[model samples]
Target: MSVKIILAGGGTGGHIFPAIAIANAIKKQQPDAEILFVGAKGRMEMEKVPQAGYEIKGIDIIGFNRSSLIKNIGLPFKLLRSFVQVRTIINQFKPDAVIGVGGYSSFPVLRFAQSKGIASFIHESNSFAGKANMMLGKKATKVFVASDGMEKFFPAQKIMITGNPVRASISLSSITKEEGLKYFGLETTKKTVLVVGGSLGAKSINEAIDAGLEEFEKNNLQLIWQTGKIYAEKAKTRAEGKFNVWVNEFISQMEHAYSAADVVISRAGAMAIAEICLVAKPAVFVPYPHAAEDHQTVNAKHLVEKHAGLMVKDNEAKEKLVSSIIALAKDEAKQNELKQHIAKLGVSDADTVIATEVLKLIKK
Candidate 1:
């Protein structure tokens, strides 16, 4: 019999992309499997999941408003409504298993699945676990994690350290630096720096890069900048007529960007870190200060402690980011050292491993 599965969760690319990777891996192993995604209504996953060629159902849900208590007045009603929607989805789909990849929507779907005694799994990409995942972990059949020592968050017996599943386009990329530069209409001779601040973009990183555009030019460094939607117009205006820079709201083909870059500046989101590690590029991370439990900082610090990468705090990015990146770009020895160390941390087959395990357990 063909297996049916529901992959739930995703507010950001960090969650959505990994879920897609896992879904793809599952399809590769079980060609006849039917997969569906459950995400929060109007969230990025509602749009991104379909783009990845998977069907999805959206629940009316929102996370707590940490910055404002007034904004959370409707929280209970939303959660209650989402559980109702999840019940409808699960009853209609009758999935053989459910997987939560860490987002607000994942909670209702996974919680409902566990209540029904359907096989349920979770992928917690961060060292620091989310509150929803922690609660779900108790009843989860399995909990896949990016690193070791996750027993503190999930049941020790349920934890599996498979590492974060990096998008195949990156982990398996064969694009040459020259080919990548040509894709961006940049010169192969100039050193290139790739700047990415997640799918929503980073205001501090954007401001710093904007302020230091001339400095980058002075140092003969070029850039392939993914400004996200929020800063796209401002970045374009700042980069106008600059042959050394290519600025866009998003880079659909990030493999090219990774290949072209000699140095990288990025937010320390789990998926971003995984991709960067796979690409083995020298990177300077600026962790988003407001991430839940400040996990982004923990992610960056883990690498920095091992000398695999460098970091600048979010508030310091405007003053220190450009100079740090420029110095790293110019230092081939330092770059190579970082590349070697960081490459050691990359896991190329995590998707396959997670998929195989999920299928194996569910079949039993």
Candidate 2:
């Protein structure tokens, strides 16, 4: 009989992309697998999941507003309504297994699945676990993690250090640097810096880069900048008539950006780190200060401790980021050292490993 699986969770690209990678891996192994995605209504996944060519169901759910208590007055109603929606989805889908990839939407689906004795799995991509995932871990059949020491968050016996799944376009990219530069309408002779601040963009990073555009030009460095939506117009205005820079709200083909880059500036989100490590580029990270449990800093610190990457605090980016990138650009030896060290941490087949294990256990 064909197997059916439900992959749940997604608010950001970090969660959505990994879920898509896992779905693709499952399809590769089980051609007849009927896969479905579940995400919070109106969230990015509702759109991104379909773009990935998978069917998805969205629950009327939203996470609690930590910054503004008044914004959460309707939280209980939404949660209750989402559980009802989840029950209908579970009853109809009757999935063999449910996988949660760390988003508020996943909680209801996985909880209902576990309550029904359906095997449920979780993929926690952060060094510090989210509260929802921690609660879900107790009953989870398996918890896949990106790094070691996750036993403190999940049940020791139930954890697997499978690493975060990188999007295949990045992990398996064969695009040459010259071709990548040409794709971005940039010159191969100039060193290129790729700046990415996640799907929503990073305000501090954007402001810093904007302030340092002339400095980058002065150093003869080119840039391929993904400004996300909010900063797109301002970035375009800043880059006007500048042949050395390419600016876009989003770079749909990030493989090209990775190939073209001599150095990278990025937020330390799990998927971003995984992709950067896979690409083996020298990077300087600006971890978002407000991430839950300050996890982004923890992620960057782990690499910095191993000499795998450099970091600048978000608040310090405007003052220190440009100088750091310029310094690293001039130091080829440091670049190579970082490249070699970070490359060692990349896992190219995490999607396959997680998919195979989930399928194998369910079949038994």
Candidate 3:
């Protein structure tokens, strides 16, 4: 029988994309390996995982709400119910090992596997570990981290710095800059700015860019703006037919969008940071202020400290993001500095490394 693995995590693309990357790598090595994905019901993974050609079972899990205590009231019951669901899924899937990619949905899946004496693995993508991953790390056969110095979060012996697994679309893209621009129907002669606010829109980033569209025109820069679903309609209204601006709810061809860019304006989510590093673009990170323990800022600062990227705070983006990116684009020296430093951080083969580790720990 071929190796069977249960890959779990994801409410957003951040966790789902890496999980898919790891699964793909495993498939590359073990062509017959059976992969099952465990995700939260009604979450993005339910759609994304199946789209990636994996079978997924959704658990009735809910993450804790930091802002609304009332919304979290049913968390305990939901968690209990999810644990029952996890046990059932594992029993049927008969997975050789379980991989937790850091999200509430991953908790029950890994926990149930551990109870059965099954080897469990974890991949912590953030600079700061989540509480669930910390608890699971105690028994995780190995914990994959995106960066070093994570010994504080997991057992030092188990922490392996494999970096985050970026999408194949990004790592293996053959698209050239001009081709990328043409794919977006954007002009090649203009400097293109790719503005992204994760999967959900960043209200502050949206407002700032809406206020600064004129500045792009003033400086003769073209824009490839991803306003996310939240701000897409209003952004389309503000950016329509400027002859230089392309505003959309999402960029389906991210590789092209990355290729089309001269500079990026982005939120500093771990996956976003990984893709940016892979693309080697000079970026201005506006760290989402309310992320768990402000880890997004820490992720951005790691790049900023290495001179790989610039940062404007969530509160400060309105006044600084557009101008800062404009200034960085003009300075060839600074752009090269940021690109070289961030490029040094890219890990093109993280999924393979992680898959090798998983196979080793499973012992056939």
| Clash count list over all predictions | 0, 0, 0
User: Could you give candidate 2's per-residue lDDT for residues 110-204 as a string of tens digits?
Assistant: 99999999999999999999899999999999999999999899999999999999899888899999999999999989999999999889999
Give per-residue lDDT, candidate 1, residue 210.
Answer: 97
Per residue, candidate 3 scores C-alpha lDDT tens digits across 215-259 of 998998999888888899999999877978988988878999999
If scored against the real structure, what TM-score would every candidate get? 0.99, 0.99, 0.98
Stretches of candidate 1 off by over 4 Å are none
Q: What are the Cα lDDT values of the candidates?
A: 0.95, 0.95, 0.91
Off by over 4 Å in 3: none
Better of 1 and 3 by lDDT: 1
Candidate 2 achieves a global lDDT of 0.95
RMSD (CA, angstroms), candidate 1 = 0.8
Write candidate 1's Cα lDDT for 163-196 as tens digits.
Answer: 9998998888899999999999999899999999
Alpha-carbon shift of residue 305 in model 3 (angstroms): 0.9
